[model samples]
Target: MNITLKPTPEIILTGDRATGPLHLGHYVGSLKQRVFLQSQHEQTILVADMQGLTDNAHNPAKVSSNILNVVADYLAVGINTEQTTICLQSQLPALAELTMYYSNLVSIARLERNPTVKAEIQSKGFERAIPAGFLTYPISQAADITAFNATLIPVGDDQLPMLEQTNEIVRKINHLANKKVLNECRPLLSNAPRLPSTDGKNKMSKTMGNTINLGASEKEISAAVKAMYTDPNHLRVQDPGQVEGNIVFTYLDAFHSDKDYVEQLKSQYRRGGLGDGTTKKILEECLQSLLGPIRNKRAEYLNDKAQLMAILKQGSQAAKEKTEKTLFDVKAVFGLNIL
Candidate 1:
């Protein structure tokens, strides 16, 4: 009989843009998964300042300011600092070097066809008038993933193309060098990956002024709840309501833990007796309960800026060492290590 040993756990790389404070959309989308991933794998969270600046170059200060906020949000959401390393993308020189090399392997046409990049360009109204960096960010993202040799990346449906792009680079590079230096990453898609805007217009974010932040105040939560979009046709309590397109109910479905209670509410609303006011009230309460502890934890992290900065610095150093090893291996394979 042959003896078998368990393979090492895979590395997980996931993070957020420091464009603004994270909101519930991020929580439902990736943060919660990251919190769980910490213990299960070699998880490293990147505060993607460089990535965030691909579009925010005009206002670099905004990108700089939100770095700590994103870190605080991560810690607040239960991302264990001990198990998961949190690093700043800008501090990782190896990642930038990797991006430059990876760019050579990819054609301009391939970059343009990236669905996530294309959608982002359209959403930002850039069309063809986009920055080169914005267009080549998929390569940057690939560098971010490969530097850590990450095998599992938590992403939404839109980011699947980016992951595909990363693995494309991995295959090309490894095949060319005949060495598996870069690891291919796959997406961990959440069942409910995106939360629509509070008013159901589109994304929930700072630009839209529609998101409820993880550290939102009670008053702010109240405001978001009141502003939440419900089926316009369901004005009267006795009117038959629609649950399919209601953003308030959508939020409840994501945040509320009690399945039976939520089903009861949905039944009442669909059966023509539940008022929008009542449902909104329930959602507000659910959000408040969910966000309250996160608010406290975020506050604790923010209050001690020195400690937060220290944690990030330590993690950044660890990340630098890992990326350095990868860069050294990659350079040796290609005879690019002239230094």
Candidate 2:
């Protein structure tokens, strides 16, 4: 509901933690939209390695191994590096410095109050021994946004509280530091909210074993598509089906080209005439059409590992310049500037 009206060519901060390869949920939920925004906004796609290390500290190799995989996933999904700055979060020192300052602006209790954090904690099953870094991630995210002076943050509705918390930190820091160093960020909500997995059990996630990777081969995607959940009530071909809760239809609505045809199919399905196999075949074809090119592109990048890292390094350097300048101004305000 809170849409940006005059949509200026402002900076945007959006990315995923490089803990694993991105999946379809990641595409529909954010990355696909980010691909379009890259042309319109001054976008920065962060591979949040620092954040990834918070929970994955014990498995540093997992974090290290997935960075390129994540980059591959981005490129595979048509995210142009020339238009969007793709930077590794752990490589940015300014972000760390900014996080240190922001930590003072927020209370421990406030971090506990963040709904996003609460949900993450429960999902991760970290009830008692929550890591300090994990608990303070919202502040670190605030630092990431403010360090880049990012005005637009593309996130899902579940992360609205995170945007609110970041703005609150911005206001608090600006007043406390006696300088308006941080800019308030607006949430560019994904048109598709949280996408459910093929299993229809929970949100599509890497850990849930229900995701179809963005770079999956056509054959692999077909196998996954065949197992996708549909209307349970419509057990047989002649049973009246429901499209409202069908994930197959949801994917079609999100990705398919022929919307009218899909709508007609849904109507027929509900009228107890259409077969589930027929509908699934349509869904499979739609998905294959979308994913085939992405798989090819990912294969190309995976073959040339050095070239991929070069692009990442180049983008990281460019992003560092912007963050360094912002960190300098923030430090100057706090009188932490050594020279």
Candidate 3:
């Protein structure tokens, strides 16, 4: 009997959709993990232009415009370019081919059943006109993961269903070929998964217009704070404020480092003394303290557009080489390659 050795698990694949500038929600949810994981793992950050276009097909220019913004966000948030390979998703032909191959292993019914897809379609109000590409993205995501043989995928808990779908496809291909050509990926959920929108939406998203941009100016931050939803019942400053649905306290809970102060404010608000203005003021300060440096770093990266694109192209080339080998092995298994 021959003993087979397993490669040490290190390859990590994680990224952002190139639709807009990353916001405070993204920074807290996923960006923080990318920063930490890059140091320990062979990480590849793909600015997912193809994924972005799945929904924004009509506005292709939005994806292109935001690619550099995503790059700047990644670099500014401390995803070291030297350590973490940053690339554009469209540059890799192998990923597209792999997606096609993997798509054959899945069914239309199963794709329709994906909870994440269903929830997203409902959220976007795309029930009547849902795009086929948008519905089948799990197959493409599986391609991205298996093509890189990614063992670690940093994501939120809500994305667990997508990983399950990916592993199912991997198992199907491996079982049919009688060989382990693909690896199943595991999700590393962020400690702070999301920051609720100041505008009282369940999630903070660009579409919701409820986000505080990572690179937002002082005026923008102040404006967002002013617009933050507070206690509707607390009409007067002296009236008791409920913290449960109040977006101001929600943000304060997440951003304000001073827990003792936050708890004190909570007590005052509950007892009917603290005003929304005071809470907003504190939240703005906390955000300014946190986001000020990130804006500066983003500006530095944005100022040198040529260098940013060059770095991304280099990473794309490296990614292309890796995915090529994986695709070659997969094609060979299926007798699709003449070799």
Best by TM-score: 1
lDDT per residue as tens, model 1, 83-173: 9999999999999999998999999999988877888889999988899999999999999999999998888788899999999999998
Model 2 / residue 168 / CA error / Å: 1.9
Candidate 3 lDDT score relative to the true structure: 0.89
lDDT string for model 2 (1-339, tens) is 897786569799998988888888888888878888888889999999999999999999888999999998898888898799888998899999889988987899999999889999999999879999999999889889888899999887888998898899889878877878779999987778677788888766666668888888788788887888888788888889899879888888888888899889989989988987898899898888888888888889988999889989998999899999989987877888887
Clash tally, candidates in order: 0, 0, 0
Q: Best by lDDT, which number?
A: 1
As a whole number from 0 to 100, the lDDT of residue 109 in candidate 3 is 92
Cα RMSDs of all predictions?
2.2, 3.2, 4.1
Point out the worst 10-residue segment of candidate 3 by lDDT: 201-210
lDDT of 1 at 17: 80
Clashing pairs in 2: none
Using TM-score as the yardstick, the better of models 1 and 2 is 1
Q: Which stretches in model 2 have alpha-carbon errors above 4 Å?
A: 1-7
lDDT per residue as tens, model 3, 1-339: 998875564899988889899998888788887888777789998899999999999999999999999999988888898899999999999999999988888999999899999999999999969998999999999999888999988888889889999999889988988989888888877788367887886576777778899999999999999999998899888998899889888888887888999999999999998888888898899999899999999999999999899989999999999999999988877898984
Considering only N, C-alpha and C atoms within 3 Å, which residue pairs clash in candidate 3? none
Give the distance in Å from residue 228's predicted Cα in candidate 3 to where it truly belongs: 0.6
What TM-score would candidate 2 get against the native? 0.95
